[model samples]
Target chain A: MRKPPYPTVLKPYGQALLDLAKEREEIVCLSGDLTRQCEIDLFRDALPERFINVGMAEANMMGIAGAMARQGLIPFVHTFGVFATRRPFDQIVNAIAYPSLPVRIVGFMPGVSSPGGPSHQAIEDVAIMRALPNMTVIDVADAVEIRKVVPQIVDLPGPVYLRLKRGEIPVIFDDDHEFFLDRAQVLESGEDVAVIANGMMLSSALLAAEALRGAGISVAVVNAPVVKPFDTRTVEAVARGVRAVVTAENHTIVGGLGTAVAETLAEAGLGRPLRRVGLKDTFAEGAKTAPHLFKKYGLSTQDIIDAAWNALGRTDSAPTAAPTPAETGEYAPV
Target chain B: MPSSTTTSEVSISRFADTIRLRAVMMVAPQGFGYLGQALSSAEIFAGLYTHAYRPGHDRLVCSPGHYIIGAYAAGVEIGLLPEEALLTYGQDDSDLEAIGTETSPAVDLTCGSLSQGLSGGVGLSLADRIKGEAGRRVFVLASDGELEEGQTWEAAMFAAHQGLGALTVLLDANDSQVDGPVSEITTVEPIAGKWEAFGWHAVDVDGHDPEQLVRALDETGSDPRPSIIIARTSTRQGLACLPEDADGHFIKLPPDLAEAAVQELESRLA
Candidate 1:
C-alpha cells in the first residue's frame, strides 16, 4: 500500500521546543540520558547551560525538575513515557503535582513509537498521568501540533505532561488549523459515525474515515490531542449526532482516549454502543517490531476499519474479524 | 516582618536540649510516635531552621516527611509557625496536619513519600534563580532511608551539575528506618563519598552538634557546587526512660512508660 503524502511544510516538534528554549532562558530542559532518543539534542546544543542530563535516572530527573521549578525556573523534564510514568510517579505526584510546580514533563517515544520492545513502548502513560490531580496531559498528533503546542504549555499554570512521538512525526494538521488546549478539532465531518482519536491513531482514523466513505459509510474524525480536560463539549456534541462512537489511540484501551470517550458518553447520557480500537488491557510484548505488534493489537488502519464498521452495526460485512484473546494474549496488561 | 535573631548563643548543647524537649512534648500528646528519628534529628533541624536557613514565607520542601514533628517543633521555636499548632499534632481537623498540608502556610511542600522533596525544592529554587532573587535558599531535609530512592541521587547529580549553589540538602543519617536499621535494609554508607562523586560538595558532621552544622552551612555559602550536609546522628540521642531497643521510626510506649518518659524529659528540662 502507498503511504499517505507527508506534510511538506511541517516542522519538527524538537525544533520548536529548542526555539522556545532560546526565547525563554528560564525554560530549562532535563533528560534521563535519552537526549537523542527523546529528540532533546537540539535543546542541549543550543541551550547547554539550561539543559541537564541526569544520566538514566528518571526518578531523580523528576525530583530535580521539581526542585528547579521551585527555584523559579521552568524545567522541561524528558524521558521515555514508560520511565516517566513508572519510575518517578511519586515524585510527579508529590513534588510536581501536589506543589502545582510549573514542571513540563515531556515523555518521548510514547505508545509504539519505540521499536525497543515492550520496555520502551509507553502504551499506558495516559492512564497513569490522567489519574493524577492537577495534571495537564497533551498528546501531540504530529510535529506541527507539537511545535504549536510547546509555547502554550509554558504559559500554563500547573504541571504539564507532553507525550511526544519520536523520529519524524507525520503532520495531520495544516498551519491554518485552529488548536486549543481544551478544544478538539473536527478534521472530517460526517453524521453516520464519529471517530475520536489521538496520537498515531489519529491519522489512521482519518484514513479509516476515507475508506469508510468509499464504502458509503460517512464518518466524522475528531483529533483530540489534549486528553485531560478533554474536549468534553465537542465530544458530547459529536456523540449526540453519531450512531455509534469508535475511539482509537496508540495507548491501552482502558485509560487512554477510549476510556475518556466512553466515560464522557456515559456521563452525558449519550451512551451509544462504543468500540475502543487500541491495545487491549495489555503491554506490548514479543519482539521489538512495531508493524507486527501494531497488526497484532489491532491498531492499524484495517483494525480501525473493522471497528468503525462494528460501531456502524455492519459487523457482519466488516472486512476484518475481531482479534481473539488467544491470538494476541501474550501482551498482558502492564 | 523580619525579626533580629542571632545564632551566636545557640550552641550545639542547647540545640540538642531543645530537640529532646520537643520530642518529649510530641510524645506527651501521642504516647508513641517517631521519637527516635525526631530526637536524633533535633540538633540538625535546630541549626538549619534557626541559624543557617533564611526562613520567611518562602518554601522548605521536606521529603522523608515522616520526620515532620521535628520540623514542626523547629518551626514553632523559630516563629515560622504558631507554637499552639504543635499542641494539635496528629489531631483531627488541625491545621498542623499529622502529614504535611499544601494549603497550610507553614508547610511548603506536602511530603510523605521519601526522596521527593529535593525535586520540589529544585523547582522552587529554579524559579527563584530565574527571577534573579538572591538570598532565598531551598533547603531539603532527606532521611537516610530515602537514599534508597534513585530519585535522590538523580536530584543530587542534577543539582551539582547545574551548580545550584542556592540549594542545600541535609541528609539526616539517624541509622534507623522503618522495618529495621538502614544498614540491614540498604547500606547507604559512604554517603558523603557518593555525594562528592555526584559533583556535590559533601560535608559530614556530628548531627547532634548545632555549632558544627552551622559551620558547615556557613562554609557552603555561595559556593558553586550543590551543598550536601551528611549529619551522622543516633536515633535515640537525648531522651532517657525510652527503651534502648525502641525503634525511633515508631516508638510504642505503654501508658506508664509514656508517663515515665515524659517525667524523665521534664526532669531534664528542669
Candidate 2:
C-alpha cells in the first residue's frame, strides 16, 4: 500500500463527472437534495443545464433516470448510499435494471463509511445491486479508479451501480493506472495465502500482506473493483495458486464480494480454505469515524491478518498486528 | 402526444368501442385476466390515441400493467400491431403478457408495478426538455389505485415543479383495485384537488365520455403546467354480459362468460 503523504483529491467523483459531462452533451446529472454531499456540485456549476436537483424523492429520481436513459441521455443519479440502492430498489429494478437502461447509480458513503448510523450507511448496497440482473456493480478504490470508472462505465451498454467514497480520495493507483470492467488486478502474488479485496479494504489487505510477508507467510493480494462481472478466471487462478483465500470488502459478507467469490469457488469446485473479512451479518452503529467502525466491526488490518492466519490453520503462529498506517489526512483507508 | 414510443396513429367514440372489444378478445382466451382494468381504461386509451397520439412521435407510458389489454386494442386500431396478435394474448411464450412488461409492444415503458408510469412520463418529458425538444409529448395512462403509492405523489410534485407542459396523465379513476372498490381500500377521491394541490392542471372527466376526455387531454399544455385528466370510470362501463356478482377488479371469463362478454362487445361495435 502507498504510505501516508499519498496525495489526496477532493471530490474526485464530482471532478471526473464534470470533466466527462463537458465532453459528452448527452450526460445529465441528478441529485436528490444531496448535490454537494454526493459531489456533483462541480458539474452543476460548470454545466447547470445538464444537472437536475430532483429533491429528496429517491424513487422518483430513479424512474426519471431510467426514463432519461431511454431518450439516449445518460443520467447519473447520486445520493447517500442507503437512499441510492435500498430505498428505491423497486424503482431501480422497474425503471433502470429491468429494461437494461444505461443510468449510472452513483452511491456515496458505502458500508460503515458514514457516521450517520444505519440510516446513512449503505451496508448492504453491493449485495442489493449485485442481485439485480443486468446491473454492473463496481466499488472503486481511489481517485484513479473513480476518474477512470466514471468515463469507462458511460458506454457500459446497461445500468451500473457505482459505490464511491465521498470527501478527499486517496491516490492508491498511479496516474496511468488502467481499469477494466471485467478484470481483477493481482497487486502481489504469493503461494500460501491469497487476499482478494476491493474498495476501502484493499489498503488494509495490502498492509496485512506486507506484515504476512515479513512473518515469512507468503500472501497474494488482489484488487477486485468490479463485483458483478466478477473475473472468475482471475479469482479462480488466484485461489488455485494459494493454500487459503481471504475475501475482504467494505460491505456485509453476505451477497457482496465475499459471496461472489464464494459462489465462484464453489461452482468451480475449488475446495480452497476461505475466510471473509467484512461486517459479519450485522448492521453498523453510528460512529465518529469510519476507522473506529472498521476496528470495532472487525474490518481492520489486524483483523485481515488474523482472518488470514485463521484460514491457513496456523493456530500456533500467532498473527502479528501490522503498524496501523497513520491516518495522515482527514480521510485514509485504515 | 409525441412520446416517441406510443406507435399510435392515435381514437373517438368508435375507437373507444374498438379498444373495449379488443380487451375482451385478449382476455377471453385466458378465461381470466385484468380484464376489468382494460374495460375501465378503454375510453381513456381511445380518447388519447385518437386525439393526441402520433405514431413514431408520441409516447405512451402505461404504468398499470393490467391496462395493456386496452392499450393493445388501441394499438391494433392504430394499425401498429396485428389484430391476429390479440388471439395469442396470455398464450405460451407470447409477448402479450396478461400484465404489461418491458417486452410489451406499442408503449414506451410498460410497468406492472403501480404509480411508476407518472414518473416515467416526467422522465420522458424531462428528457425531451433536456435535449431541447420540449415540444415532444408523453401521455401516461395510470390507474387511480396507484395513487396509494408514494411514488405517484413524488412524480406528481416533480412533474408540476418542472412545468412538464407536454406530459399528459390520463388517470383511469376506476373506483376498483384488487381488494374491491378503491374507495373501500384507500380513497384517492378529491383526486383533482389532490393533483391541483401538487401544482397540476387537474380535470376530472367521465372516462367513458370521448368528448370530455378529448377536451380534458387537449388542455395538457394549454397553460404550460403538467395536465392530468382524472377520467372517473367503472369496471362495468361497456360490459353488460357479466353477472351482478362478478368481481369488478380482475374478471374471470369462464368459457360461457367469455363467450357472452365477446358477443356483447361485438354487438356494441356493430
Candidate 3:
C-alpha cells in the first residue's frame, strides 16, 4: 500500500477497460448519456462498434446489457452509481441476475462521492445489490484495484455490480499489490482494533490506522473490495485477534461493508465491540466539492479514528484531523 | 433459418388448437391459472412459432410472465418442449411456473418482469448485428397492460434509436388486465399511433386470424426501423363451452367445467 500524499491516476478505469476490450472481443461497453463522467469515453473512442450509447433510459439499458450477455458478449454498463443501481434494479435482477448472465454493472461515483446530492448519490447501492442472490457486489479502493479489477471480473460466472469512483482516481495500492474478487487485502496485522473498509473510505481506514499506531494503539487494516461473497475466513481470522472492530465505507452503515462485517462476525460466534463509520442512514446534500460531503457525512479519516477509539474503549480525544489526503487534481478518496 | 427440429407438417389452425388444448391441460390440473392468456394468445403464438421463429437462430422473448402460459403451450404443441412437462405446471418443484420465470425454457431470457422484455430483445438484436449475424432476428411477446409502465416507452425509444431492424414486438392487445378492462385502468388505445410516433413500423391485426398474424410476422426485419404487430384479441377467443359467469381473466375450473371445456376443445377437431 502507498503512503499519504499518494500519486493519482486519471481515467484509470476507462483506460484499463479499453485495453482489456482490445484483447477481449466479447467486452461491450454501454453508456447512459454519462460516458465522459463515468470514464467509458475511452472505450467508446477506441471500439466504436462494441460501445453502445443507450441514451438516458437506464431501465432499457440494463435489459439491453442483459440480452447482450445472453448472446455471449460481456457488457460493461456504465452510469452514475444511483442511476446504475436504484433506477434499474428490477431489470438488473430480472434480466441479469435471475438469468445469471455475465454482465458487469459499472456504477461510478458511489455514496457521497457524487456532488449531485441525494438524487445522484448511491448510498444504498451495496445494500440493495448484496440482497440479490446471484449478484457479486464490489467496491474497489483505488486506481490500482481499478486497473486490476477490470480484467479479473470479466467472466466471473454471474452478474457483477462494480462500484467505482468517477474522474481522477487515487493510487492507494502500489503495483505489487494484487486484487482478488474472493480475497481481502490485509494491509496491516496489528491486534488491538481491526479497521475494515472498501471503496473511497479505504484510504481513510489506512490513514487512520497510521494515526492510531502513532497514538500507541495497534490496528489491523483490511481492504474489503468485494462486499458480497466477502472473504469471511480472512475477516474472521483478523477480527478474532482484535479486541474491537471498525468498518468504514463510502456508503450507509445499514447494509454496506459495515453490515457485511457485522453479519460475518456475529454468525461466526465472535462478538466484538463494532463501530461503523459511514452515512449513518441519512441522505446527503449537493456540494461544491466531494470532500465537503464526505467530511460532513462523517466519512473522513478522523471518523474512522474515532470509531476505532470508541470500539477500543479509549475515551481520550480523537486523533488530530489530518491534512486532506488528495489535492485538487486528484479524486477524493474519503 | 428454421429450427432443425421443427416438424413443419402441422397446419397453423391445428397448431393454434394444439396450443389451446395444451394450455387448458396445464391450467386445469391447478384448477386456476392464467387461462385467459392462453386463450387470447394461442393464435398469435401458433402463428409465430410456425411462421417466424427459428428455435436455434431467432430469439423470442416473452415479456409478460402470464402471457408465457400460451407460449409454453405452443412449445408443447411442437416437439421443442417435452410432452410430459405440462403435467407439472404450477406444481411445487416444477420449473414450469404459472407465470413463466427466467428458469423456464423455450423463450430466451425472462417474461417474469413486465415491460422489460422489449429492451432485452433490442439488446439481443444489437448483439446479432454487432456479430454481423444478419439472418438472426428477435421477437418480444408483450401484453397491452404493460403500456402503462414507463419502462415500456423507455425500451421503445431505445429500440427506435438503435434502428434495430431485426427486432419485432408481438403485442397482444387483449384489452383486459387483472384489474378489469385495460381501457378503464389506462388509455393504451391509439397503440399503433404510439408505435409509429416511437419510430416503428406498426401493423394492427386481428390477433386470432392466422393469415393476418402470418403476414405481420413476415414483415419483421424488413427495414431499418423496428416493427410491432399490435394483435387485437379476446381472452375468450376460441372456446365455445365456457359458462356465462366464467371469468376469462382467471377461470376457476371445477371437475365438471374442466371436463366440459376439454370435451369442447377436443370436439373442435370434428
- Model 3 has an lDDT value of 0.87
All candidates in order of DockQ, best leading: 3, 2, 1
lDDT of 2 by residue, B114-133 (tens): 88888898899988988888
Backbone clashes in model 3 = 0
Tell me chain A's TM-score in each of the predictions.
0.92, 0.97, 0.97
Q: Give a tens-digit lDDT track for model 2, residues A74-172.
A: 999999889999999999999999899999999998889887888888999999999999999999889899989988999889999999987878887
> DockQ: which is higher, 1 or 2?
2
Name the docking class for model 1. Answer: medium
Give the alpha-carbon lDDT of every model. 0.77, 0.86, 0.87
Model 1: what TM-score? Answer: 0.88
**What's the TM-score of chain B for every model shown?**
0.90, 0.93, 0.93
Residue A44 lDDT in model 1? 86
Q: On residues B170-245, what C-alpha lDDT tens digit does candidate 3 reach at each position?
A: 9999888877889998899899999999999999999987777877888765866899999999888778777655
Candidate 2 residue B260 C-alpha distance from true site, Å: 1.9
> What digit string (tens of lDDT, one per residue) describes model 1 on residues B89-190?
778887766556664434466477777777666656666665667777777888888889776776677677667888888889988887888999887989
Lowest lDDT block of 10, candidate 3 chain B: B1-10
- Per-residue lDDT of model 3, residues A36-113, tens digit only: 998888888889999999999999999999989988999999998899999999988888888888999999888998
